[model samples]
Target: MAACQTEKEEINFPKTDLSNMPMIPKPLKTIPTGSAFGLDAGTAIYTSTTDPAFEKVGRFLSENIKSKTGLELGVNSSSEAKLERLIYINQSDSVDLETPESYQLYIKKDSILLNAKTAAGAFRGIQTLQQLIPTKSNDTLTDHPLWVIPSGKITDAPKYGYRSSMLDVARHFFTVDEVKKYIDALAYYKFNTLHLHLSDDQGWRIEIKSWPKLTEVGGASEVGGGEGGFYTQEEYKDIVAYAADRHITVVPEIDMPGHTNSASLSYPFLHYAGAETPRVRTDMKVGYSSFDAQKDTVYSFLDDVIGEIAAISPGPYFHIGGDESHVTKKSDYILFVEKVEKIVQKHNKRMVGWDEIAQADIDSKSIVQLWNSADNALKAADNGSKLIVSPAKKAYLDMKYDSISEFGLHWAGYIPVDVGYNWDPETYVEGISKENILGIEAPLWSETISNGTELEYLAFPRIIGYAELGWSPSDHLDWEDYKVRLAAQVPYLEAMQINYYPSKLVDWNKE
Candidate 1:
């Protein structure tokens, strides 16, 4: 194995300026305190509150420290940590906080205090804390010794409330462990949402007890005619719980009307009579199969499927993919979306669909994700529906890095690292301003990629840039300065064993 591939292998610690540590999604404010804190075996972590969530945050920090350095720090459930060197996690009762994910980190010579209004805030702050600890230590203890963190104060919060990363598990089924691994990477960058595209033409990736055949038959085949898999309710819940622990919400998507070949194949009644007998689609072609919008049985089937999925999904939104219905008549397509939106709401989940859903009379409370058309986005804004901006050219992670890229499609055009990082979400679309937006999401449609290595290659570096756009202030964005900080993130990526693309845009800190 290459030396850089192993986390324990010693590497040169870059001569970084402490004040400007390479932190992604740069904090809202950072001020150097001209001091440093030494974290050693004697250090203990104390929590101000008895809440289990707060305690979990404390454990998370200690566990990460133990993993990176051979130091097993103690965690104590106490209100105070006196004289002895310690790290404190506190939940504040302040009402002046910007958002639920906001937190303040104060590092002094003797102690470190992380304060936040909620446990989620504390969890987010812990990410910053992890970033502060250098990948390599100073002493000759195999480059892993007592860690020193530069003293500083950081007041941080995401500019947008709904930063998300969408994974298309339908085209390619990712195992629960694989999904958890992706969630870990998202948490490291402080992303709060993981949108799982659960169903598509190629496969149905989630189980519905009422519709057993949905998984038994529809889930049997994937994009390349491989034996696909599905996640049982228990496994699906496991993913949700794991994400929640990391302060990330999992949003489930079940595409309908157009991307329903799998569903139609499972139950022919769901397929339109005019189309050929529904068959397993191993190709990437879309907009060919659709649900019979006129049938009352279709709505009943959807209600049962939506209810089963919604009961397990604690998140507030459910995605009914409303894009690419070329064969369905315009009127039928609009009516189908209107009915499905009601079904989503019947289960207490706000409807979220692709930009095409804007053509329907969707509820003002629903959300429209901008993927292709600006007119559709503007129409959504006009209807008072908030938007999740994921313009294909800028935020699509599955787009090829260049013409020679081995994996991914380029219909949306190649999204080089710099092109992906340079666009501003707040001003990307003219009609949809910040008020109409609910943050941004980078959708990775798994057409050419299958395993974790290919998935990580397309997601990293670019997705890192998306995380920054979602969290940091819009006016403060700078590609030049940001690239330097991004370069410093190489160690963390390597340590995590992520097969990330080494973009030439940044001078990586590989010393």
Candidate 2:
């Protein structure tokens, strides 16, 4: 994982078909050594008897398959007879395989079997099965489609426990259904975490029953000076459920201390007289408005907000955004973050914040999201805080892929698809080793993205890059081989109607 193993020796993937197939986020291990498995009218899926949890997984896969192939593939428990043209899933009691997400898949001529320790691992295997479906003519998925796939044995598990993606909705609000679309796409790439940036200077996107004005006033405008919207408690709960059903955890973020213009405008008591008069910012400027950290009422307001957010979001980690606070005094910033951490802990939620939290008296058990210097990340890791590496230079999907790009910013430099795919999370920083690392995250700040189409255009291809980096082993990553597989994914993406920026580095016609 050292700088993606120096591009001179790019990694390779399993050699099976020279035809169309989605290739990014290569599995941990794959070997094509058996006869082809045909997905036809007779295919059936089976679940584990020991764990009834897989019944849901079986139904999910069966529905997707039915939609794509127009085949009513049967789904039954292990008690049923093992039939030909089958996809089998079972739980293993083996002790050496400690990770719950670890799984082994064997695709043979007549039967494809997947074995995992838990239902979660089995669900990850289902993602791979979808990828195995042919990409060519993917738009015309039918019973007669070429359902043949090369027989292979794949032993796979994620390299990082917290493979994540962040969506900044406050800068440009997205509806609940749109957010669900984003979650489904990321989950397909093996990303397990969904960090929702729900608050910023432009908008506040979640309801607070105690403070009804937060959404009524603060959620009334976005960055472009348009009417904004906020999610009701029930809507937010549905989002959480949708994400959990797909094996993705929702990490709701309430950017506080800084990025509080919307809040200050709603509740004037949170206003600092020294700062600019509170107003919803239409421009993408940072570090201006801040909460009155010293005011006891401000803490009381945050207490209510945090309690409400934590109640809806069942995820263990609650993200208290503590980044970019230029207007707030250093002492005030520290005190603000310190109080936020205690509030989060009191609600029985683990705290997560930007790397700047390392500068304050933050909780050691909290997870620090690194978006700036490696020195800051190393410092946080050295102090016993887990690190979520998302250096803006390489990991920021919001950055344009090149200078000529029509969408996204270039402050982090143009992250070409190769540049995005080549940097490994494990070795991106010199001093912060895997032990210090909690996982990897790619943040898509929606400064330029206003809709799901724009978000997909910025995310794809690069998002898949981060997905592979977090799942595939360090030694297994190779840019040269990966580029080929990466190009192959174009057809599948097109079939799904994903609006992706086609990089010149890739030969799309090759697929």
Candidate 3:
């Protein structure tokens, strides 16, 4: 193991004066600004898109723009506006945008053009455009005169195809509204995937129609014994659709075999230690309980659970929680994993599991999400399976920044922002390069995040680093420069009313 890999890298807030303009997960390359285009009521969002979905995206963007600026920017296909203050969000024929998420934005004195090859790209560009639209005041639903974008050009695409953030909703059940807020925040940071940890030992979040008791009994209470809530099938669908509209694929995780206490509680015969009645766990210990790997009925239960979640989840991947199976025998663990893998495959979804699953007999195409060291990551990648590098020490948002920090765990090293952004996912391990890397993910295991403010406090600045690592190109990555850029976002974060922790390492005092 490399000495520096484990050693905590210190933060060096850049020496030079950096731009105060906020661009979280900054664009690849932006040129000098010219004249600015101020948005007004007459401005129209012009797009020749026939697809209702893309048109809906335009409407969504228009609505948000209108909300920020108090300008009713109508979505018009007929390009006949008098002033020509047009926001063109269209699929371009001129530029060869090879990636679905690639976009080019050109801001001129009169009009702004955002072009891409696909709706996904256009949506990403909208996120960038939103960042460019300054908040003139801290008041919500108030008009902002500075809802203007400086004249510049930005060609942006993610460095890794799958930039993800996982929210462990089961540990602390967040409402649908809360989840949407999280999705919007993730979209702002340009993250493309929201891996929803819908199931855990404490509770089951999504309504599984085939398994009614899973929610009726298992979802009734959360970790601290609050009346837990579960997203109904319709509500879950709404979340999937909402995420899709924002160009974020929702990867739902229904962890089984180990995080199966909730499941076992719902159906007592499902078997952890051969069938004793169980209750939803109120504690935080792992591997003390799991599904009966020996039972054929347990396999049937998996089929039902996996089938329901897979049916609702439109994304390609389904995450099976295959971590910390300390209680199950090694053979049983491997057996259970193999059975679950087949069930996922039967539903036409690719398998995703924690690094522990790499030890099981899984298909080469399955994705392994790593929260520990690189050993399992390297092992899985070597076998042709891709790895999402979310090492707990680096990417787990729940870990406290330093000893003085109030809200998170210290097990994963104190990850200040620089430590979060310093490591390159592609070069983290010896053998793992860009090819073996699927993307990078920052996971917030919600043991401590009980409310929206707490969640934001732990997630921001650090999660911003996750976005930068996944989006910004290798050459553009510099922690010193990034800390400055990150510090630049304080006003933006403040204006948005997001309760982010102002790091002691950076100067947040107004210049």
The better candidate by TM-score, 1 or 2, is 1
State the lDDT of candidate 2 residue by residue for 1-511, as single tens digits. Answer: 2442242133121245412345446777777774466676656898886677787788888887776667677788444332446788888876734588888888876678988888888888888887886543222333244466667787788888999999998999999988998887887778899999999999999999999999999999897787888998999999999999988899999997888999999999998776788976889999888888899998888889999999988889999998988788989988888988999999999999998888886667999998996777887887899999899999999999887887899987889999988876767788888998889999999999899999998998789889998888888788888877887776567766788888888777543
The total of clashing pairs for model 1 equals 0
Clashing pairs in 3: none
lDDT of each: 0.88, 0.83, 0.80
Best candidate (score: TM-score) = 1
Ranking of predictions according to TM-score: 1, 2, 3
**Cα lDDT over the full model 1:** 0.88
Query: How does candidate 2 fare on TM-score?
Result: 0.92
Candidate 3 per-residue C-alpha lDDT over 1-511 given as tens digits, one digit per residue, 9 for 90 to 100: 2432222122111221112345767787676465566565546787756655567768989888776767767786565434446788777765557688888888865578888878888888888888777666223222423344666788788888999999989988988888898888888788899999998888888888888998999898787778888999899999999898888999999886787788888888886774334676777767767788888998888888889888888999999988887778889999988888999999999999999998887899899988885888888987899999998878899999888887888887888877888888887788888999899999998887777888888998788889989998888888777777787776667667788888877776454
Select the stronger candidate by lDDT from 1 and 3: 1
**What is the lDDT for 504 in model 1?**
81
Model 3 gets an lDDT of: 0.80
